[model samples]
Target: MSFFSIFISTANAAGSPLKQFEIYSIAPMHFGNVNVSFTNSSFWMLLVVLVSTLVLSLGVRRSSLVPNRLQSISELLYEFIANMVRDNASQDGKPYFPFIFTLFIFILFSNVLGLIPYSFTVTSHIIVTFALAMVVFIGVTIIGLVKHRIKFFTLFVPKGIPLALAPLLIIIELISYLVRPITLSVRLFANMMAGHTLLKVFGGFVVALGFLGIGPLVVTVALYGLELIVACLQAYVFAVLTCLYLNDALHLHH
Candidate 1:
């Protein structure tokens, strides 16, 4: 058999469907000399933003002594993030509450939106996640410098270290600081991509096996539920880490 045929046969044996994901270019645009291609992922991202805005806005539109369902949910979400900020970030970091809260909400919405059928998973792409990571990285760096001026470099120096080991410690610190963006971006992108891919493969098996595929179908359903939890958890993790990073910038803790 040809390679394609063999691949299909293997998928069949493993109870995977033969469906494959395709990346499509939706539009081409130019910024100065740079060219950018908008894709299906971009569309889904916009949709997530719109839906999130509507949901949150509608939920908080009215205030009652005892909140109705929507108001209660909105208040709960607000309190959750407010507590997260208070717990992780210092007093000096309170001004950044809006940015951090929006970051969490956007990530949560995008992840949940991607779970819908026929939807594109924007967080699955390294470029998209990396861009978000870079924003946090760059913003924190700028904040550190503005707050500490030349003394911001002190962030790289660990307190109580011996003079002889100071250089080594600074080197390690610099490397760790430089790697934050890569780690942050890769963690989100890899988890989302892997989970979605596994879901797709298992879903394909259910379709291909006809009546015999009930086992995999049930497992896929279970995994889908689990993925929803993971999606929310990952968003919370990303936001909490961002808060931690902001705290480091504000306090210059080693």
Candidate 2:
């Protein structure tokens, strides 16, 4: 084989491995006329839920006064979310604690799990992130309406504004409010997807370079560590934003 031919074959093989990242439909079984199809993303979501449930359950199963290692860790996580809610959403945030806690746990687990080799990152996809963002958007909207009634429109109209500027302010507020879901979902999906794709591309370089791969390998490891921090940070940011939105719903601070 010529050198050029060998190079082409190696390049083809290298590219072929990336095909594992491709999303595909999984057919579990047919339920009569309906076909039950699951995507790789959905599978990861389910795994996240199951793993999170098991971890928390085991952590809290044996409640002791002094506390064991697992229980203490669980308690710390609880306190972290509690403090975040209290600080961001105020005292009334107590009512939305469950929703906020669940959001944090789900996102945190999904992100951390995705860091593992061969694992799928569901949050890397816009559909999953958008679905989550839409849920928050709808819930906040409903809460605002329920709490303020017709006064919910006040959210788009700033108080203390002059009558002359009210229309302009309202238009700006309306546009900002409408853009929340897009911003929230895209921020998460873009970050996760970009980080993972970069990591994968660098990792591929590390493998393809053979004996000269050490440079890319070291960079890949550094990036992996950075990605882990990003995973947690993104989850925290998402949860904090949700709390802020909930606060707006309950307090209408516009």
Candidate 3:
């Protein structure tokens, strides 16, 4: 049986840990046989976007000579991503700051917001993470192709290798490059899913044990804190990796 089905089967006996990840349609819609319903996932994603935009906009709306808390926060986030891009992708990366900033903010908010009770964690799903990764992968490839044309193929052929081993190394590199999306997506999805699953399991234990629920409750609290850190870290890691990839495309570095 599928993982979700396993959860569905046991849901009657005890709440399944995976139950939280289930997507529910808020407003079900069908275009012929295709379902395009507004789901909890969609709602959470929309909330994330709106929250991010409002926070950033409000943060700088009253910018002044003496920065207020909101303005300070806004500037900090701006500098954080700006420095990340410049440090990893170099000065040439300045032009792409907005794209990287938007990406980081979106993922960061999605992840952090998902930590809220009853909210859906979009990054916990492989499909969502994979789509984001593919966008980065495809965009990087396009930049490389446009900048270097025929030389873009050199990305798979490192700097120093014996002719005999060059072909083998190139093949290996090509395979690795092609799997970037899978690795990137799986990393985020697996971390978010595993963390939340553990939290749910422990939460269930707390309820089941009643008087002896203190231990599980404590553990659940700790996991929530850790998950919060992981959420931010994963967003930073994703942005950093994107900058690295962009650097490779722009500089043709091995």
Candidate 4:
């Protein structure tokens, strides 16, 4: 079965860990071989995009020498992402700031939005996260090949390696490089899925345990707080890693 379709069975069919990632056709449509239907996942994705755009647009509508609260928040995010790219990818990375910034914000917003009662988290799906990772992976690979040509191969062969060990190290490096998308996608998906599953399970306890559930409720509150922090952190880590990959591509550094 297809990776995206794997979530189909469990997502909408039942109330299980996988149910949160389910995508169903809101208005099912078919164009020959392709199914172009608007599903809940699509709804959430559009909502994420809309909300992100609105916040960013309104946040800096009135740019000023002395920033107000919204403008300050906007500037903070701008500078924060700028510094991340600068630190990891340097001046050359400045050109891709918008892409990186959009990605960071989108994921951050999605994660935070998911914490809302009865809301869906887009990043919890492997297909979604994998697509995002693949974009970065492919983009970096293209940049490296375009900039360095065949020399991009050197990325797999570190300097000062003994001649005999070069083959082994090169193989290891190649495998690691190729697995980036798998690891990146799985990390975000697993984290969101695990966090939400815990919340769901504990929520059931709260409803079932009644007054005694106060302790679990308190823990739930703390978990929510931690999840918020994690939402922001995972976004930062994803963007930072993107910059790092871009740095590798641009400079061909080992």
Candidate 5:
């Protein structure tokens, strides 16, 4: 193919909303019966991890008596998650503070990373989000089981309820409990995927319509601002929900 043809093909492929989500192997490999090949998704995840670690460490490396910009941000995020835990999950949730804080930072970084041009959004994939949610779900379940033993089952049964309606409520509660991962995963994945897709669509219009695309380009710029907010908000929402779930398992309020 000619150079111009190649460039056109590349540009068109890059503009597709779904194209950004594609998982292509970077260094294809196999582990016996499993395909554990490194992929764009995997690469992005590693990048996120590295960046998170670097920022947190370097941010406070100086440990100044008076905080720098980096130190201030690190402390702000730390206190934010700590206060959130205190308010939502109470002192009982203190032991799990590190887990919750790390969870928030990871998702928050993943969302922000996806905003980079041509970067993959790991949370946009159901499997990634589902895996994270499962950790929270299973962790809480184990905590409940270990703490309350068989009595944890009583969480599904409310006090002073009519015997006739007990079975119905139990079934409803059981299903809801089991479906936490699904809802949690879908909420993050759907929002990130949909918002990114909309941005991609507008971007394509800008390239295709040229001068006539000025309006769409402006909307796309506005969307970038909104998506940045959403990226942070979704991370906060997921973290808060996890706290609520943790509280439920720990205290059985609902």
Candidate 6:
């Protein structure tokens, strides 16, 4: 069955609007005590990767003096992200353009794909977003540690602080530093999930109200467009924050 058809059936079978977000095993597997089953979430994530790779590869494959639609889109995205990295993360961050670009594309596609009726929204799941955030957190931490060694700890201790305030300030900085993953993950997760849930609610009302549904139908259409913009914005926000964090690791209040 087609993915959309399967999702439509699954979603229709469940009453709750949030049931659309549920993850269920498509192909079950087990190894000893471990249950590592293929799931709807996994399928959508894999699809995102495939779609991103395919579009980008095709977009750049036939490079031209005057670009076609795919090439134009590819070049635009590349320049946009390259400038973003340079502006936010500085010259040192140019080396990591591929990572930032990939992160942005992946989340953007996942968020956009979820807007389709009954498609699973991977970023709406805390586990997925948290995992992505942790990768960034750990990566930047390692980069800082490798570049500055013990001096990396200075990130948690601002310069020119009063002696009395130094300890408290250090504690505050440290706590905030550690909370990066939680905040970053929750921002994307909460936005995507809440937006989808609200859309679903209004959509249901439109159906139930019939002719009186015009008001709710109009609201639902507007919400979908808003969510589309929000999906792209959230991806940009996440990528920008990542660049900012990487800048801290690379330049560290220089």
- Residue lDDT tens for model 5, 4-85: 5753554475566688899999999999989999999999999999999999998899899899998988999999999999
Q: After superposition, how far is residue 35 of candidate 6 from its true place, in Å?
A: 2.2
TM-score of each: 0.89, 0.90, 0.93, 0.92, 0.93, 0.92
- Candidate 2, run of 10 with poorest lDDT: 11-20
User: Roughly what TM-score does model 1 have, to 2 decimal places?
Assistant: 0.89
List per-candidate RMSD values in Å.
Answer: 3.3, 3.4, 4.0, 6.2, 4.7, 6.1
Q: What is the C-alpha lDDT of each candidate?
A: 0.83, 0.86, 0.89, 0.86, 0.91, 0.91
Residue runs of model 4 more than 4 Å from their true location after superposition: 1-17
**Tens-digit lDDT track for model 3 on 19-47?**
98999999999999999999999999999
Alpha-carbon error at 212 in model 1, in Å?
1.9
> Which runs in model 6 stand beyond 4 Å of their true positions?
1-14
Tens digits of per-residue lDDT for model 2 on 76-195?
Answer: 889999999999889988988999899989989988998898888878878888989999999999999998999998999888999999999999999999899999999988888888
Q: For model 4, what is the alpha-carbon lDDT of residue 214?
A: 87
lDDT of 2 at 223: 98
lDDT of 1 by residue, 1-254 (tens): 79657435645775432132356779987888986678677678888889888888888787778988888777888888888888898677678888888888888888898899768777888888899999999999999999989998999999999999999999999999999999999999888888888888777677766786697789899999999998999899988989888888888886
- Model 1 residue 186 lDDT score: 94
- Backbone clash pairs for candidate 3 read none
Q: Ten residues in a row with the worst lDDT in model 5?
A: 6-15
What's the lDDT of the predicted structure labeled candidate 1? 0.83
TM-score of 3: 0.93
